[model samples]
Target: MSPLTTSSRRRILFVGEAVTLAHVVRPVVLARALDPARYEAVLACDGRYLKLFGELPFAWRPIETIPTVKFLDNLAKGRPVYTAETLRAYVRDDLALIEAVQPDLVVGDFRISLGVSARVAGVPYFTITNAYWGPYSQLPFPLPEHPMTKVFGVGVSQALFNLARPLVFALHTLPLNRVRREYGFPSLGTDLREIYTHADQVLYADIPGFIPTAPLPPHHCWLGPVLWSPEIKPPDWWDAVPEGRPIIYVALGSSGENERALPIILQGLADLPVTVIAATAGQPLGIKPPVNAYVADFLPGAEAAARAALVICNGGSLATQQALAAGAPVLGIASNMDQHLNMLCLERAGVGARLRVGPLTAKQVRKMTERLLGDAGCRQAAGRLRETLRDWDTGQVFAARIAIQGGDGQTTATQP
Candidate 1:
């Protein structure tokens, strides 16, 4: 077969932070989708998702990240997830990887250390992030789950949050700025968005209409949703899932809000006319689901989302994107800024409903679920968004950007 050779090849290393499956899986999807004949694809990531890596034919190696619990705790406390010590450790690991791969270009998903090491190694670096995190994003910054919200009600808390968000973003940027200065690179300024997005090229895994961003800079582009679902066998219950009633799919995912959300949601859906299909994402709900519900450790969320009438999740972009991709409206119980931002965009598009994680109740859940279930307008909006996304091939866009950054493959061919 001659290994399906190409005229010129570049070593493209994908560094994925493994605090959650999303970070790791996003890069894995891209690495596998690259034309291997034109690029030597390598995924250097922690094995938090070792189960999800089997079919990736590219080369791979281990890269450690902080414990997921610790990362979640930081988010819960409204503190920076990565500290100087952790990021310093990450830089050491990242440098070792860059040296090992000798990659022509490195693509990272939330792998912040690459901002320093990729430059030190003189390699081209690209970052994949959500559009809402970009400076040009127009989504309203709702008050995330913060202490301020508890102290002063939603209105006052939101007012204070709007005034203090820049400072908060600045505070989050300190660790990376300190690390960059220590390595002789210029500070990335006060905007944490710049710090988080420091790269030779920046790609947003979102659509312009759904998230509604201002005109992006030349280096930044919307790569659309780099969507991937776990390749797990559906459970026995999947085959016989009832088609007699409206289906509601519930998934909290691994977004640090699993304490009581699933149980509460299940309790709320107990007597509804709908049949609920739920996914725990490998977390156990300490309470049993109602007779009207079915549970799985993980499901092909995209498939289940398409089958259901409404998709309920922790309001992160991953699930909401899946739902929208399937033409299903969303019911989001959002906690952190990321989830809140995603839900806000859905609300703007009129395809979803949002409930605060802190103030959420089973009654609110039931009411919103009923409303979203019956709203033909919401379904129309989701279907419209689905049509917009139907033609976007994120993998193709990602590959084209790599070709541009690799100088149309000419530079790689000339390399010694």
Candidate 2:
């Protein structure tokens, strides 16, 4: 165990890679939940989403991440996200922040640089990630909409992807492994799962039993979903949603393929009897909504999900978790691997359906929405999961996990 500061509080430094909003938002939600009295938390992240947050309870440090557009493009192309040079720079920044904070424990959300920096700094590191990314996971890997999928049809593309999947994942690990060697550490091998989970402790941000996996090691633990919604006011049309017709809530999130799919969703649901509520995750939709649809740049997501009969999204964990927490069935039009993996778990759980974004049609969206809205079994599954989610006290669970390292005292909040 690492030593606490003179103040006797366990200093925890949280680093989030702002490559996407979900990465930054997950850490912020967890950092806010810690008991300020028992733990001293300092958040180091890119300033892109800082304005979306309210006044933070703990200290804040500015850090740098690759541009979101570049990250997304690389993922879309199925290429290595970080170059060796980019990771080297990330190590420099991470070490500087670690030295400044002098934290006893480090918690990171998708900031892969810390796999090297935290070990170099001799601190206990815990990483927040999804269960599907774990080596123990039994989830199937579906071919994402990459170059191969376009050049060849999905049937042939999927076959090619399966044969090349191991090599592709190995390529993504090369940059991180190169940086580890620079830090005088052994290479983490060619397995991308090992690279993502190379920390002292691995914390999964998911519901237990949702994703099938082999028996986990003692160091790996489920932290549950770190749910968060923007604290913004609802649109002028929030209360006017009629009760006679079913309500459908659609959100593509910040990193979701929103620009391509939102317009089709609006047009497809236009002729239906239901009312449509959509949040653009702050992007300009450029397209007009149907008379039955109310589109906004942002909305308080939790309330919207609770009010909706069905939730349509990009099948990422953040939005899907929101819908599950509200007892709303999901209709995920997934584009990337992460979103596809998440939707697969939801499908197995019987609370949602998955549609490929590559061949998505407004007709398909309307058909799935109609099916989920009428599926009583799906609704019951969501409601049961919602009750389970409500019972998970994420803040308390987190505090308990790290308390043994230092600051082993009663967990109490000071309203940060």
lDDT of each: 0.84, 0.86
Candidate 2: tens digits of C-alpha lDDT, residues 11-50: 8899999988889888889888887776778999999888
RMSD versus native structure for model 1: 3.5
Q: Which ten residues in a row have the lowest lDDT in candidate 2?
A: 407-416
Q: Candidate 2: TM-score?
A: 0.95
lDDT of 1 by residue, 254-276 (tens): 77477678888888888889999
Model 2 score (lDDT): 0.86
TM-score of 1: 0.94
**Count of steric clashes across candidates, in order:** 0, 0
